[model samples]
Target: MAVSLWHKKVIFFGGKGGVGKTTCSASFGLLAAKRGLRTLVVSTDPAHSLGDIFATHIDEEGQLAPNLWGYEINPVKESERYTEQIKSQFQNVVSPVIMEEIQRQIEAAYSAPGSEEAAIFDKFIDMLERIETEFDLVVFDTAPTGHTLRLLSLPELLASWIEHLIAQREKANRLMSMAAVGSPELKEKTDKPDPVLATLKRREERFRRAREFIVDNQAASFIFVVNAEKLPIMETQKAMEILVKYQIPIGGVIVNRLLPTDQEGPFWTRRRELEKKYMAEIEEQFGSLILAKLPLLPDDIYGRQALDQIVQMLEEQIID
Candidate 1:
């Protein structure tokens, strides 16, 4: 199928830490960009390595390259953005005291286990909605598999909550408007309801739209980057199950750092032998979905030259 059906078609790279997810994501974005598509590589991991892979400095916005752009989101900056939006939308309806309390609550919420992940997810969805018009493809270098699953699952969880909030707001609005022209008894009943309900309704609508953009497969897809190691492979399998359970679209998997088995001598022979063993397991487990295999390079994978090699490797068919 053509990849264009996905409005935003985000390819997320996620797996066990140290599995070369950032390098793979950068290579994919570079390849897409080289093919004449405007591509953006976004890094959501706290310890971002996209900048290192691209050999360029990136901040919250982005830095331009030949055909690709890169961005490393700062959690503090994202938290500030979230707070500003909440304050602007609720300033008029919420009392000053209530607004202060809400700000404190939001800060507290950000410290919770999944708070940062949720904030990053919201920023990603916001970027996809607003800036997708400027780029043909968006590649995300996500955190480890565990945190990435939490990020992907946020859309469905938030969708249900937003639907309930919207319903409650609709009910409140009808009652409040009726109170404006009805009898004194009715007016008294409506006046007691909190005015913040209207603002809440608007917020819920925005969240609903974001959720739709995420769950719509035509707009998003996830790619798991894994190695041949036992732990990494197990984590990838578990991650696949979670993504499928959430109804998120799964793209082909990228098996990174595969050893070339056609070399001579004992050192090369042992390396090749070990690789063959894991390669067989990988094929048996995910044969139908393997997209690319990247061989382990002797030097560090960074800069345009190295990235180009990685791209070429990704484009080649895996040899069984």
Candidate 2:
């Protein structure tokens, strides 16, 4: 079946590392722009390649083509931004002693386990919220499967963590009221709202909205790019299962870098035979979700002209 963008507004291209996700995503973004839709090609991978593919610059402004824009989010920078936002929001309300402690903790979290993902997820939520107003199509070239899966599951994990924090904060507030005001109920009927709790709840709500948008087919679709090989196939299969379990819709799988239809020599022949077996396995496993098959090109994919050829091939194979 041909890959179709008729229904989905946001498309994510994700797969095992080194599966040509960057190339395919760039091609799709160019194709969308050529079709007269305003498009944005975004790279969520730490190792950026969108700029390399376009042979130009991609930055926060995201202007890479006539009708297309590009952005590559650096997780470290994003995490810093997220930390600053938190500090700014809380510094005013908390005491000087507590403020200093919070500052220390936030600084210590620069290399925290999930800090990068949390920051990136926040940016992703912002994109999802503004995609329709900003562009007709937004194609995400995400990180490797394991990292991307962890990213997708962040909302669930973060929400639970936030809830636990909120519960603990409430208990502390009750204790504070009992000690100072002599009434546990005073915390509930406080004169002012708790800005700290308010901020956490707001973040939780944002995560929920992003999760809802991702699971909606009309809002977002995830496409897996895989080469017909052992490792890529196994990884893609696991990714598909995880995404499906989360109720995130899978648009289909793109079989990239297939062997040439006609090849000479024993090595080429043997490689093609191996590809055939794996390709059959992919078909048997994914069935109707197999969207397109792209042949391996002779040279490295670079610049607009080469991408244009890929777009043409995609248009031919993608479902109408």
Candidate 3:
């Protein structure tokens, strides 16, 4: 079945490195904007090129066109911001001695595994919360296959981790409540709200919300941009399996950068012939999941006019 992307509130374009994910996603965002839907295209890759494609600087977020906005998330900056938010939550609640120790742990956590993903996911959740109110459609031009896969899978994995933390917090609160039955001072302390528990519950709820949005097929779509090559095709297939396993909605595949059929030279002819074989393999492997085929453009995809061409090509094949 042909995929209809215009209606999706959240659309993700992900694939192997150098497969033109940024260009495709930016073009789609531009298409949505042209259709009068307020659109925001975001780049979650650390090495961002979304601004390069649009010929505009978008370090955080900025208006690109009339109805389109662009954002390039910096992992380091987001991680730092996330860490500060975490540290602020413990202030005044914990004693100075304990606060000092907590600060040390937070510093250690800055370098821990998955820290960057967690921080970036927090920002991703922030963007999701603004959907509908701020923009009609939000397109994510994500990192390469492995990194993007981990980012998408974060909702499920982090939700489970948060649930465990909530459970532990609840258990501890119950123990405190039980022990406070005798002493008036302890009873007063237990009766008052627990800041730590409250923070944990809020984080848990945010993760839950993100998971719901990610798995909602009607609201979100994940598309892959692949080149007519062995590596990209294989990577896309693997990425699809992971998304399916997590129940994230798959929109379709876009085979980008196809060789032009009109080229006359022997080398060009051989390249197109090889491209045909891989294109056939893509059809065999993905079948109806193939959404669009984009040819190699004469010039680099930059600025509005070049991006407009991409919108034209996509509209030709993306009909439902």
Candidate 4:
């Protein structure tokens, strides 16, 4: 079968926690790398297990196999770096008094709840921008469904938000220019262009580009991993709705950890029956989007050898 994901530049694997998104992502990366495609598997989940699964330590980026790299985004580190970058941009542009006040406000904003998400989104953009340059395919192992949904929606949300900020900044700059009309030196400073306004415009454009890249069906796709269980099925349904709302392309759904059909005994039979019910629901709701169904493995999936099993399944079963 032709691999559908092979043609896409960016792909995301997301679902409820513990449904095996990381395994699927790593397996896909392994398969892609073995195919001679340069693949980078990045974990956006804060509670990262990508390193443990690969049996390798990956801080920013590390080679796991030939042509395959892994990166676990550190929110705290990225947040600190993002804050410093923002602070650096303000220097030599504003007076000392305004700079100090801006620094204080920035520090305060750093403590806000969504700051880490914002920082991670910036890093996410960086990874998306790296496609076809440093890597041929970028696979994201995202956080749980809700958190991942929020993260995916950032480009849309921030695009408009940044545009508004740019508009306000432009208005403020116009007023400053009007006030500076009396002094030639002040008018010269105001007419030259506002650095802050320029920065806002740059940010607006960046978010706009990110938004465009994400919504492009040919370039990007999102795969959701779900177990044939009640909560996972429900959460996956809701998450699919959110993705549809945002116009992010849905690659397909992977039903993971399915019970073995050959198992015997009353407990096994009962569990299979329960799974059957949920499986039917899955079919009814997501029939067209089903990509692959992975059975529960006998051994823990760690290291490249274990991952190869998953890769084999994906290689055989993934629908285009």
Candidate 5:
């Protein structure tokens, strides 16, 4: 296994289900922390396995080890945070009835198909903004390939929608102003356009900045984690294409659970042969973008010592 070539950039691990993405991400986070980078690893999957990998009980947010923080985002929590912020800002301008409506809307948004992805995107943005001054790296243990692609592509889609919303808000402001002079009904409509328009404008700016930050190579990168299997390989290829379509930088691919070449026996030989064949295919498909191959250990990789062994494998490569 080789070492990674990129540091500082946010590394994302994604692949098919049961591909050991959480383990690889946890190992990488440990490596980064050992390098004194002040790393944070986050899991976006609804069925998060980071705690299992670390062999530690973790709350929504916890420090698994020194210089290493881990989090499993609860969309409900994020929705509440956003709701509170919006409520506080718009309390005076929006009536109590409208405020309650907005709260319902926010909850609905969080439960919607894309709301969880949006919440994760918001958290990533918050991390990026803070990492600029506080941390050196952030590793994301993303959900399976399908979910990760959806999550990563959200910024672009959200940016377009927000742009439209901003434009609409501006138009609404103009309409309200013109109508204010017309009648009593119109006057009520335009009376408090300032707060609503201002809130939308601020949110639009935040989304735009976050979108730009994510697509920028210096700020973020996507790494696909896969095992040497037909399904995982095909899934990784599809994910790579989707990531490129979204303009997210491809960091590299991590091939986990590779059968070791040593250990003399018929079963060992057969397993090695299969792994070598698949390894060749992976190399041909991904080329130099293949970053590391983690050998399958005799037992499950867990706790600090096993994590250190994984990091040792990573450190052997030359990270460009």
Candidate 6:
């Protein structure tokens, strides 16, 4: 009497690079929306091809069709925004004399490894949280497998880090109060809440909820988009294992870019032979989980009509 992950309200499409993740995600969203679900498809990839696939510009709020919506999260822009917000808060809280040094520190922190990802993750969580109130379904067209795995793993990693930071700040504040025994100014300062610590705790809470939505509630489903190539097959296998380790449910796998069945030349014949072997491997590895296999179109798939064909395929194969 329970719903499967495929029927879940949120889905994620991810795999190795150049596996048609963006295009597949777009088709899925369009199909879901056409079925009368208010669906929002979002791209968490820094190099967004989601906009190009849909052939329409998706803004911050993500508007595309009557029932469908889309969004692209640019890492550089998000990192800048995230840094500025933190800097603004620092200016409001810290002393004027320390503001210049604090700004420099903030700038350095923004440039650090993982800072951009953390910012992207913050926005990612925001979208997930809003899905319940805003749409019937949400689909994420994620970056390559490794990046997505790290992003999904953040709640656990960052929560512990934030807790440690909070504990250290508390200890430092207590020590200051003890040292300032009879000084009213220092005592008053220690009595007030540490705004920085408060901010960290708030972020920690958000991560906790994000993790719950992903792991506990089974609200999110991961659908891998892959080609029938050896590398993609191996990478998808590894990525699926990682997701399983993290207790994230996988909905299915989509095999993209199938070569034509009828071939003429020696080159085409040899290519077909190689593709057949890999396709057989794909079936051997993930046949039961396979949702759809899309062909390699002669022309680059674009515009409403081309995407409509994809949507029609999904409706015929799965959703309908």
- Give the alpha-carbon lDDT of every model: 0.77, 0.85, 0.91, 0.91, 0.79, 0.85
Task: Provide C-alpha RMSD values for all models, in order.
Answer: 3.6, 2.7, 1.5, 1.7, 3.1, 1.9
Q: lDDT per residue, candidate 2, 163-273, as tens digits?
A: 899898888776666665755576455646788878878887888888787777766889999999999999998998899898888988899998887779999999989
lDDT of 5 by residue, 153-178 (tens): 77678778877887898887887788
Q: Per-residue CA lDDT of candidate 4, range 1-320, in tens?
A: 32367799999999989999999999999989988999999999999999999998887789999999999999999999999999999988999999999999999999899999999999999998899789999999999998989988998888888888888888888898899988999998988877898888888888888889888888899999999999999998899899899999998999999987787899999999999999999999999889899999989899988999999999898644
Candidate 2 ranges beyond 4 A from true positions = 1-4, 178-190
Could you tally the backbone clashes for each prediction? 2, 6, 0, 0, 2, 0
Candidate 6 structure lDDT: 0.85
Rank by TM-score (best first): 4, 3, 6, 2, 5, 1
Candidate 1's residue-wise lDDT over 182-299, tens digit each? 5887677566656566666665666667666656677777878888878888999999899888777777688888776666899988777777888888899888778888888878
Better of 5 and 6 by lDDT: 6
How much does candidate 4 score in TM-score?
Answer: 0.97
**Model 3: how far is 235 from its true place, Å?**
0.4
- Estimate, for each residue in 1-320, the C-alpha lDDT of model 3 and write its tens digit: 43367888999999999999998999989888988999999899989999988887876999999999988888899999999999999988999999999999999998898788888889999999989999999999999999988988888888888889989988999999999999999999999999998998899889899889988988999999999999999999999999989999999899899988787999998898889899899999888888899999999999989999999998788887
lDDT of 6 by residue, 1-320 (tens): 43564457789999999998988999999888877888989899888888787677776556777798888898888999998988888788889878899888888998999889989998999888877689878899999999999999898888888889989988888898897799998888888878888887888899898888788545778889889788999999999998888888888899889998886899998999899999889999998889888988887778778888887877777741
Query: At residue 267, what lDDT does model 4 achieve?
Result: 100
lDDT of 5: 0.79
Model 2 lDDT-worst window of ten? 182-191
Clashes of 3: 0
> Candidate 2's C-alpha lDDT?
0.85
